[model samples]
Structures are given as structure tokens and as C-alpha cells.
Target: MQRLTQLITCLLGTLLFGAAAAADAILPKPFTATYEVTYRGMRAGQITFKLTRDDATGRYTYETTADPSFLARIVISNAAVERSVMEIGPNGVRPLEWSLDDGKPGTARDGQLQFDWNKKLVTGVIEGEKIELPLEPGLQDRLSIQIDVVTSLLRGEEPGLIPLIDDNRVKRYSYVKKETTSIDTKLGKLDAIVYESTRQGSSRQSRFWLVPDREYLAARAEQIRKGKVETVMVLQSVQ
Candidate 1:
């Protein structure tokens, strides 16, 4: 049960967002989306994602909530929440803060991080331990990384290797374009561009099916481990 809960939480962490448009390209948009989550071919739960913007400050708050289903509730009792606060600029999305609450308060899985771009550092607490790391160019948090990738795609640019702060360490993920395909969703059948992302030195890979006509929204996503699909999230609705 503990292992299953952990896998579900990991799937929730990988879910992406549907973004808005900027002056010349699509940027992060304030919207709400829902996805039906499945784990190991079984219905697991649902994930709700929201992105809100402070128009005056131009800062965006992206959040996601994972609610386990009735069957899954036996093992996963609480909903996990992840949030990232960031801004979009000429370069790309810059994450200012990131946090995760695994639904259990006071547990080691809960953490918060603050990014100080001026100081060129990221300071935070994870697993009840303090951490500080030097910032790198184009650094992003877990949630913001997807937005950055989508932004690059919207601009007709390839999102090669992206460096993001994951938990206590900075990890790099390589994004590669895959063949274009069509998928059936609640909204109807739509064409999508597939992109695969793999973390360095890991066998786990995630694939995203994004619909370009709909502002590059992710229509479906799957997390694969050892070449076998472990979790899947399909778009239910978007607004």
C-alpha cells in the first residue's frame, strides 16, 4: 500500500498544465483543468490543476490537487497538493517558489523552496532538512518546467535539455519531439504533438500529448518505467 501511494503521488507530480498566449507566442494562461488518473491499469483518482495570474504583478501561481478514488482511498487517504509560483519573461518562465504537501502534515514528504534570482540561489527545506543550491541559467521548478517546454514549442523552438529543481537537487531532463498523432478525449478527437521527456540516468520516461490548436494543452500523459506504462492521466475538461 505504501509503495502504491508513492507511485500515485509521483504521477500527480508529472501532470502538466494548459497555458495562455503572450504577445507573439503562447504563454502561461490562467485556467483550470482536470484529468482522470489511472495506475497500473486500474482507476486510481482524479487530478485538478489550476493556474492563476496576478495581472498587476504578472506572477502566476500554478497548483495541482490529487484526490484518490474510493478504492484508492483505502491506502491514500489525503489529497496531495503541489504548487509553483513563477513569472514569464523574455527568456522564459522563472519559478520563484515551489512546494509539495503529500496530504500528510508534518511528514518528511512535505517541503517548500524559495528562489532568489538576485542572489543566484535556491533555499528551502525538504524532508525536514535545510538546503541551499547555486542557481543555474534557465533553471525551473517541477511544475514550471512543463510550461517552459510548451512555451518553447509554441515559439517553434526545440526544448532540448531542461534543468529543474526536483526536491533537494537540480536534475536535468531531455525533451525530444515524437511523431504527431491523434487522441480521443472528452472534448472529441483531436490531433496532438507528442513529446517524450527522460530524466538523466533514469529509466523512467514521461510522454505528453499536446494539442497545438488548443493553445498547446496536454490532452494525455503517461509515465513509463522500464518500458512499461505505470500511470496515465487523460484530460477530462479544461476551462
Candidate 2:
């Protein structure tokens, strides 16, 4: 009977460890990253993105702000802010709410989104119209997609087809893994896995280089629109 008791205890221990490990896979390591944004090889602005998590409650908030630089700052009013608050769980990251401000006055482009998990629905205001749509399981928003991608890469898993809710439309995005490479940044040389995604029905493409050592944070990103580089951001610092 003692031997049987010992065997049961061992099995329980193993099961508990497995559960904890799985949960850790999705729990984000809180960090803030600032990237230098450039447009068509000319300095346009800077983007600062931050992530924070509460381990006890499994809640997280991700926010990003874009600020113009130099001449662009004087000529353009293109500042913007985006944020998402969600819950991280064993199943995946569930977006509780999201908001966007385009910095345009007297325009209806600013809106908010709310996710109803129990009803499997999303309600948001878009262009001054309130709409409701069915939400899919494992659905992610534009801001949350970054977290989803990083988490999947950290776990050595494919991001698959991510369903994104943005601009009053539900669009599906596909991520293709390219080759692993190293990126030279202000911080230093770092190894990363590259991923590319093309905009559906457009010539725009975006590439992300995520460094594994830094918890799969994107070290650099490039956005090309219509055969011209629209923006490029290299990791400037992290905290």
C-alpha cells in the first residue's frame, strides 16, 4: 500500500507541473519597447509599445503611442494611440476591450470594442455606427495580435490563421515563417525568427523579426506599401 501511495503522489506532482508549465507559456513577461519609426528611409516618428500583466488575476494591458519627429511633427497631425486589455488563460489570450484614437478632430474614426465571452459576440462603434458581430473562438484584435504572435513563437508553435477584428471588419491574417536570422540593433546583435504577412488584396507587406532571448519581442519591423517602404522601426530600447 505504501508503494501505491508513492506512485500516486508522483503522478500528481507531474500533472501539476505540466499544468503550470502550460499556463506559463501564455503568461506574458511584462516589458516596454520603443522603436524608431521611419518612412521611406526618412525619419517619420517613433512608436512606443508597452505590455503589463497581473499574474494573480491573469489580466494584461498592452498600449502603443506614435509620435512624429522633426519636420513631420510640424507639418502633420498624425499622432495616434492604441490600447488593448485582456485576460490570459490556458486556452489563449481573450481580448476584453480595445480602443483606438487617430488624433483627428471632428471625425468618427475613433472607436471602442468590447468582447462578450459568454455570448461570443463583439460590439463596437465604427465610423459613428454601432455594430455587433459574432466573435470566433481564439479571436484576436489588431493590438492583441502582436501578443498572440509573440506567445506562439516563444512556444515554438505556428501562429496559424489569426482572425483580426479591426476597422469594423473581421479580417483573417496569415503569418508565414521565414528563416531564422540575426538583427543588429542599438542594443547589440541578436538572433531572431522572421515572419512575413501580406495585406490581403494589396501590395502592402509587413515583416517582423522577433528575438527569442528577449521573450520573442519584435526587434525590428518593416511595412512596405505599394512597392515603397511606408515605415520601418528598429528596437531602440527595452525595459
Candidate 3:
């Protein structure tokens, strides 16, 4: 059979060139994330992001949880840099690498997280340097951490580069609205786009509930600030 049609056309051209060189790392595979943030009313704390994606180098592994006994008082608990993030690229977030809780070893105060994809804005750096956050113009009604929708959920179009693992420290924002959305539970539903300055603002409507033919993004909905009260988060399983 012509050598099985040239070995099935070389396995379909090596799976379409590995899915176009991984179209930016293809959503980081394995999923299971839940975040419920609120303001102006109270319940302003809840985070759970457990990720894993390493299908032969797509590379990614996260673990963030909240309410570790609410950590003491005034509601400013470090939660150890949101349980020490580490997303290397697809945007960038390198917050901590060691000593947490008491903070100190590298002192990453847990602040400043500037993102601005495409146009390339990239912020947040500790120990190695660069950190100056303090910008708000459209979003951010004092979100403790969800920084404009969590790096628009690990974007990818250029070899998966969106990992900001904190460095240098102390940045109090200056501007952010570069698009961010997520509602994925092992590809069930809810998927919005945009992540870093798509010209400028106005495009933050989200709704999710996938699975019709899924692979990721579980449940999502965001909007309604100012007076607060609009929020939707679902996705209770992923591995």
C-alpha cells in the first residue's frame, strides 16, 4: 500500500507540525482553576488554581489556594505570593522561588504585576530586578489578586511566553486592562479572549460553559463592577 501511504503521510505531517508549533503552547493543557473575587460587599477572598501542562515541553505547573485559615488579620495575608506562582511564559509571572509566609528571603512583598501582551509591556521582577506597579484605567476596582483576569489565561501565539514569576519586587501598578478571561475545567466551557493592550479597552464581556466539543475552559462570567454583584465561577474537577 505504497508503504502505508508513506506511513500515513508521516503521521499527518507530524500532527500538523505539532499543531503549528503549539499555537503558543495550546492553553497549557491540564486544567482545574476556580477563582471567586468580590468587592464592596465582603467575601473578597477565594482562589484556587491547580494547573499542569507538560506534554513534552509545553511546560507549566501551578498550585494556588486560599483561606489557609485566612492567615491572621486585616485581610492582607500574603498567602505566600498567591501560593508562589510560576508561569514562565505565555505572558510571564515568576513571583517567588523560595522562603514565603514570613517573607524575607528575596522579599517579594507581593505587589506589582504589570502585563501588556503583543505590544510587549511585561512587568514584575524580584531579586533579579524590575518592579514598578501602579496603573488602573478601566479595570481593577482594588482587586487583591486576579490582576485583570489572570494574564488573560495563559495566552499563546508565539511559542508560549507568558510567565511573570515576581522579581525585584515593590511595584504598585500604573495601568492595566490588557484583556484577561478564564472558565476552563479540562475544556468544559467559557472562553473569552484578549490579554495585553488590544489598542485600548472596551471588550470585557465574558460567558462560559463549554463541553459541546471541548478540551478546556470550564465556567466563567465577569462584569458588573461599580456597584458590584456580577460574578460566576464554576469548575469543580480537573486533573
Candidate 4:
């Protein structure tokens, strides 16, 4: 009788776990956060990130705009807009579309990727070049990946290997938790968890600090390439 009781208990536990996972897959509340961008420790630009959800369709849209500061504009002279549309299911994020607009002051280069989950195909173009790749589960775009990382962390799950779509290519990146410490931001000093990105065979490295109380939002990010700091983004405001 004891063995039978143990078996029933295990089955109940599994069912409950599955239910909880499905409920939390909807994602956090809608929010907007602005970050001050810096390059080599100087003011450069600003990036505003926004996330919205559709209750009826259970879809999400994530958008970010990076604009160079007036002074910095003279040096860089370009801005970027990135966006991603996806849905979070019982498994993870299922990206539907990803796009970016990057170019000079007036002329812009447009790149977009469309995911057809039903057909299991990914089609897109990057810099006017045709692209086609296999569609895989758990795939995320550059922008959506950041959201998934924070969501997984808040759920007490390890942010392990992540499949991300970038430049019309699919790449799996591994993230390592560095440490949990306090960092000063425009808002104030706050405790944060830091994570470092490992991109195989790439010289560029990136890091992010996530604030727990704020739904595990990314408070700051730094990108370095070839031992030189390329850009930095720090939390400015949240709404």
C-alpha cells in the first residue's frame, strides 16, 4: 500500500508542475523602460524598450529604438530600430517575426525574418540577400531573447542555452551567471544579477544586469568588441 501511495503522490506532483508552468507562460506585465546609452564612458545615445501584449491573441510585441545624442550624432550619425513579435507558450518563446532598420541618416537598410511555425520554416532577407533556415522550437530573436532571459530568471529557472535569430541566421548562445551585486543607476542603487554571454567563435562579448524587484528587468547592458567597449546602456526610467 505504501508503494501505491508513493506512485499516486508522484503523479499528482507532476500534474501540478505542468499546470504552474503553463499559467506563467503569458509573460510579465506590459512596460516601457528607457536607457541612457554610452560609448567608451561618454554619452552616446538612448534606447527605449517597450513590451505590449494582446489579451485576445496571446501575442507580444517588443520594440526598441536607439537614437544617438545630439553631440554623439556627429560621430556615429546613425540610429537603429529593432522589433520582435512572439508568443510564450508552455514550452518557451515562439518568435513570429523579427526586423531591424539600420543605415545612414536618410537611407536605411531593412532586414526582416518571418517564422512559420506551422510549416516549420524561417524565411527572411538580410541586406538584400535572401535567407532560409529551419524553424526550431524555443527560437527567439535578438530583442525577444532578452525578455525570455529575464522571464526565466524570475521563474527560478536557469538561463541556459538559448536559440536566437540574428542577421538572418540561427545561433545558440550560452549564458553564464556571473554574480549578484549592487549597481548604481540613474534611478538609484539597486541589487542586481549579472550574466555574461558566450557566443562561440565571436570576439564580441555582452553582459547584462537584471533587477529582481522590477520583474527581473535588465537594468544595464555593456557590449565589448576586441577588448574595446563599443556601447553601454544604463537604466534611465521605467513606466
Candidate 5:
């Protein structure tokens, strides 16, 4: 009778755990977060980023505005990359091709994504590259980069990064876990799952935070590579 009871209890516990996981699978995520980025310089960049769910197509759009002239608006879907480039010194902005691949020239439109063993959807190609954020000494310039990606998995969303490798570029992302993190914004804190990427041999961390209740990354933070906290590279706006 004792052994039978123990087995029954274990089975019940397993069932409960499965139920909880399923419930977490369908939670809505963040739609958008307008933030600012700053580095060593006091320069500022205005950013409006969003993660919108097509609902009909089940695809998500990860988009942001960092450069005002060159790379103004970038929209990335599961396998599509769309960029709007501004023609300088003249008329207006024109659309350009955007690629999010690692080895290939990437596409002018869309990036490739895949699912891990945890069933969380994430970026598939691992491109060894890094894009440096403009900074100044003694002062952190505020800048923001919008992120838009699709899928039921929103794990690569957070601020700060732990780069794994870097020959040309450092690589870093989030570890799948059950911790509750809040996406820090100038407005307030919103709960999210943050991922990060970094170039090798650097002491900085930029993170992507996905608010499960929403559909996209609500915020991101880049810390300079200083002592203890290291020097941080988090600008609220992109100039």
C-alpha cells in the first residue's frame, strides 16, 4: 500500500507540471517599447520599436529605428528582412534589403529562425559579428534599437549579454529559465524574458527582454565595460 501511494503521488505531480507548462505556452507578449540609447557621448537617438502579431499569419515583426539617415527603419519577420534606407542630402527614404543570416549575404528581407529543444523559437543562424554603439567618456549616450521577431517562443529578449565566442563578432543570448524579470524602461518595469548578444573580447552586455504577456521585446540595456559593473553601453535613444 505504501509503495502504491508513492507511485500515485509521483504521477500526479508530473501531470500537474505538464499542465502548468501548457498554460504558459499561450501567454500574450509585448507589442512595443519606445526607448532611448546613450553611450559615452551625450548624443541621443529616438526609437520606436514594436512586435506585432499578424494573428492571421501567426508571424511577428521585429523592427527598430537606430540610424536616422542610413538604416532608419528595419523590419524583420521569421524569414524576412525589410529595411528602409534614407538617401542622404536629397529627397527622401527608400527601401533597402535586410539580411539576418550568418554565413550567407543574408537577405535584403528577412532572417532565419528555429526552435531549440526547449521548444522556444530563436534566431537560427549564428553570425559572428558585432555592431558597436557610439559612446562617450564619463557620460552614457541614450539610444534605442527596436526589436521585432515572431513565434510562440520569446526567449531571446533581454538586456546585457554574455558573449560565447567572437572571431569577427561576439555572440551572446539568454539562457532558458523560469525566472521572472522585469523589462526596465524610462516609464516603469515590465516583466519579460531577456536575451543578449556580444562581440568577443569585450566587457559589455546588451540584452533583449520579451514580456510574455505581450508580443515583443519591451526594452533592452547595454552596459559599458567598466569595473565591477564593467563598462556599460546602454543609450536610451539612437542619434
Candidate 6:
């Protein structure tokens, strides 16, 4: 009877440990996804997004590269890149650094930001100007904000106002959960949850169709201004 009791206790401990491990594995596995970009109903460009992690440091790097078509290049860039490096902790995902390149050499649109949590400040250079802004809890960079939304949805929580550093200023965008619907994509049909995000005091709205099965990745995204669609992106492939 004593041996049997010890075995049962050990089994129970193992089960609890397994449950904790599963809970900690909520984040999506690293992946590379590509999308077809459109502007005003015309084929414009392609975007490749990548998410990678450093197991040793528990840090993540999310990057997006945009290659525009010749016509699109007139409005956009030949090649643009945005990257965010962040870490997840008790307070949530915190961005340590972020950088953007508009693909124009010596252009003013290229900049980078460094976050200092200990000092509660974010310092960066934007458009040939220096910036130093006070940091608030739950602050995020442009790329990290997407991960924050995905993390919140996976945890069964509503994604509230996202405070992110844009350019040289902090902007707040509120996300509103809409509906669950089926969307046709290059990979086939998928069920996705629709979300609309609007910047405070702005008429421009962004919409996302996130597939839960794909780790809440956006299968389709659009930008609307005054009820007119300005830009759209559809998932083309993932690996």
C-alpha cells in the first residue's frame, strides 16, 4: 500500500507538470508567411513576414519585408523592411528594439528605436530628429503590437487599446472583435475571426481576418479610409 501511494503521487505530479508545459506553449511556432499586396484593387507588391525565437535568451524577432512592383514603387518603396525584437514576461511582451527602412538610401524615413524599461523611456531617431519619450506600461512597437493582439486572443482576452510608438510619437489604436467567417485564401478556405482597429480620432480603419488554427495569424488584411478600401493583403503561403 505504501508503494502504491507513492506511485500515485508521482503520477499526479507528472500530470500537473504536463499541464503547465502546455499552458506555457501558447505562443505559435516560428514561421515564415508571405502575402500578396494590393493597392486600390490593383496588384501592388508582395510581403514576407518571419517570426523567429532565440531559445537561449527567450527573445523573439518579428520581421516584414515588402517588395513593391514598379507601379507600386511610385507610391511605396522598392523594398521596405520593418523589424522588432521583443521578449515575453510576466508583464507581457516588451519590445527591446525596433527599426524600419523605407528602402530609399539616405532617406529620412529610416529610423530605429531602443526601449529602456528600467529607465521607463524610449529613445529613437526618426526623420533626422531625435526622440525621447516616457514609457508606459504595455507599450509596444509597430511589429510587436501584432503579436500582442495575437497573444491576447489566444489567452481568451479582448485586445484593448494598443499603445505603440509610430514615427516619433505614441499612438493608440483600439481593436474591436467583429465576427467569425469563412475566407478563401491561396491555401484554401479557412475560418477566421475578423477584427477592426481604428486609431483614436482617425477616420482610417484597418481590418484583419485572423485564423485561429494558424496561431491567429492574419489571413487577410485591409485598410479603409472613409469607407473606401485603400490597401489589401491576402495570405499567399506559409511555412
Model 2: how far is 113 from its true place, Å?
0.5
TM-score of structure candidate 6: 0.87
Q: Estimate, for each residue in 154-223, the C-alpha lDDT of model 3 and write its tens digit.
A: 3312212222122332222222233445444544434443222111132323233322123323343333
Give the 10-residue window scoring lowest on summed lDDT in candidate 2: 9-18
Tell me the tens digit of each residue's lDDT in model 5 across 61-128: 43443332122122212222222111111111111212232112433222322222133212222233
Error of 3 at 100 (Å): 14
Report the error of model 5 at residue 164, Å: 9.1
Worst 10 residues of 3 by lDDT: 10-19
**Local distance difference test, candidate 3:** 0.32
Looking at model 1, which ten-residue stretch has the lowest summed lDDT?
9-18
Using TM-score, rank the candidates from best to worst.
Answer: 1, 6, 2, 4, 5, 3
lDDT, candidate 1, 133-229, per-residue tens:
9999899887887678877877778889989776678888888888899999898999988888887788888888888888777788888999999
User: How much is 175 displaced in model 5, in angstroms?
Assistant: 5.0
Error of 3 at 142 (Å): 18
Of the two candidates 5 and 6, the one with more favorable TM-score, higher being better, is: 6
Off by over 4 Å in 5: 1-30, 67-201, 207-220, 226-239
Going through the candidates in the order shown, the clash numbers are 1, 0, 51, 0, 76, 0
lDDT of 1: 0.78
How far does residue 16 in candidate 4 sit from its true spot (Å)? 27
Number of the predicted model whose lDDT against the real structure is largest: 1
Off by over 4 Å in 1: 1-24, 74-79
- Mark the regions of model 2 whose C-alpha exceeds 4 Å error after superposition: 1-23, 74-79, 104-107
Cα-based lDDT at residue 102, candidate 3? 23
- Off-target runs (Cα >4 Å) in candidate 4 are 1-26, 71-80, 103-108
Please list the C-alpha lDDT of all candidates, in the order they appear.
Answer: 0.78, 0.66, 0.32, 0.66, 0.29, 0.71
